[model samples]
Target: MRQLFGNRAFVLLMVSDFMQNIGIWIRNMALLFFIMEKSNHDPVAVSLLTVIEYVPIFVISMIGGVLADRWRPKRTMIWGDVLSFLSILLILFVVLAGYWQAVFAVTLVSAVVSQFSQPSSMKIIKRCLPDEHVPAATALSQTLMSLFIILGPMVGTTIYQTFGLLASLISLLVLFAASAIVLTFLPSSVDQAPDTTESAGSLLKDMKAGFSYIASSRLLKVLLVVYVVLALGSGLVQPLDIFVITERLQLDMSSVQWFTALEGLGMLIGGLIAAVIAGKVKGTYLLFAGLSFLGLSTFVEVLSQWPMLTGTMRFLTGVLMAMAQTVLMAVMMQQVDEKFIGRLGGVMMPVFTGMMLIGSGFTGWYMSATSIVVVYFTAGALFLLSSFISMKLPISREPVQEEAEAPVSVNATVKV
Candidate 1:
């Protein structure tokens, strides 16, 4: 653990990610409340904000992924943050012009840039750390995120409520600038761009190659299916989670705030446990176990009216989710060639996002036709199905293709 923390690249990345998390939560909470006030609590406006945030992931992830592969990971990441900063700066001005609705652009710009930036981040992890350190690094990263999940809303809410939208936007600008500065210190590395003579069609050809690469890997295929299926399930209950508090537990709407906090608290504990065990465990098995138990636990939540029981189940659900995602990320890092990380994510994430969007759209109609209990049941069943199917994933830890013999030069990998 000390060795991993002392690695300069890893340390810098984590710091950058921490700042990015702060910026994200600030955007999420501050914008949400601000829009609620300006739009007079119109459900359509709120729903449109959600769509704006997600639609970019569905539309732009692949393009960003492909581009990320052809660009230096460090440089791509820095540019992504810089661009996000500039975009937010622009939004701030438009809002100052009395067009508060321009706040939606903040989410849209960040979402679009993240498609490019996030893939580079995965690639950077593969480049900067040895194969063995990846799991611990992922655990640490997940733990930081869990920390944010637990506290981000409070911080964001506090800032927005106390200082208002202008202050929140300015905070995001500083955060993004800070994140970009942190990325500047990462170990210098090269990407897998084609020769200078390559034509414009090279991007298309690269994307096609990416598709073939995914097709060739049975584990990758199964993983994509697992993610999409799980997304479908989670989407069904995500928007309606408050209903769990109001209907099942017979609690007030206000209780939903504290009620949802359990998952974040659970994730913090779960991330610590996963980090400790990740290196020793078979990730595929962990994935299966997490999902299966999480499914059962979620279903258990539906069966009880007791606050203690339901809250315990939510906490357990968070633990299972964190463990599952931590291991799965480790697996992907170990299995896919570093160069293909961007392309692979590009294809997989958008499909997963698309499935989620599709499922979310269908949910309201399905619930009206049936019942909220039926909807939650459907989510649990889908999770179980994804888990069972994930049993088909290969147990091999070997990469499908060898990565570049060395991407980061020795001198560039300065350890603290």
Candidate 2:
């Protein structure tokens, strides 16, 4: 732990990411509330905001991944931050102009840029840290995100409630600018590889190579299948979570807020646990265990009406989710070649996003036709099924280890 924290580059990257995530979540909360108010609590209108945000991920994530592989990670990341900052500025102007609807467009633009930024950031982390530290690093990064999940809404809500939309936008602008500036000082290259000239035609070939590589790896194939299936379940839950808290729990909005806070706390704890046990334990086993826990928690939540029990279930759900994702990320980092991180991100993002979109749309109709509880039950079932199927894969029984020849040069300079 000390070693990981002692790295200057890691700490700086974490700080920048912390600020950016806070700004993004706060903006997300502000927009959700703004839409709810403007649409007079229409579920469809509110859900439409989520749809718009994810649509770009479905449309452009694969292309962005390809770009990430071709471009230097630092440069790609810096440009992404700049674009996000500009989008926030545009949203601020739209808010000032009383064009509430324009926020949707701004959100879409930010999400599109994120496809590039997210993969680039991953590439940097993969290159900067040693293979052994990847799990702890992944944990720490996720733990910070859990912290934001806890605080972002509270902070965003407080600011929005007090100072209004302009203040929120201004906060995002500052955060993005800070992130971009910090990113600029990072090393241009951590490892020197022979440069090769490639024509535009090579890009298509590269894309094909990425797909073929994933298809060829039995481990990656199983992981990808499980990932897409889980995304489908999460898609159903995310859009309808508020409804479960308000309608089923028979609680007010404050209850929903508290549930989120508790869940974040659980995730923080889970991340720490995952970090501690990472290299010692089989990540594939952890992944399946987390999925099973998620299913059990969801099932329990539906069976109980007591607020305390439901909240506890939610917290447990968060713990399971954090553990599962942390292990999954560690496994991916260890298994995939560092050179293909960008391409892997590209392939994975579209699969997750596209399935999620389909699930969310179907869930909306399913809820209208059946019941919210049924949807919850469905999610729980999918999670359990994912766990069972994952058990059959050989990767689940094998522990992850650093490759005999590490890809990233540990001695490579990371300026600032």
Best by TM-score: 1
Worst 10 residues of 2 by lDDT: 407-416
**Cα lDDT computed for each candidate against the true fold:** 0.82, 0.78
Best by lDDT: 1
| Model 1 quality (TM-score) | 0.91
Clashes of 1: 0
lDDT of 2 by residue, 197-219 (tens): 33333556667667766766777
Q: Residues 61-166, candidate 1, lDDT per residue (tens digit)?
A: 8888878877778888899999989988887888789887776776688789989889989988898788888888888888898899879989999999999988
Which regions in candidate 1 have their CA more than 4 angstroms from the true location? 190-201, 402-416
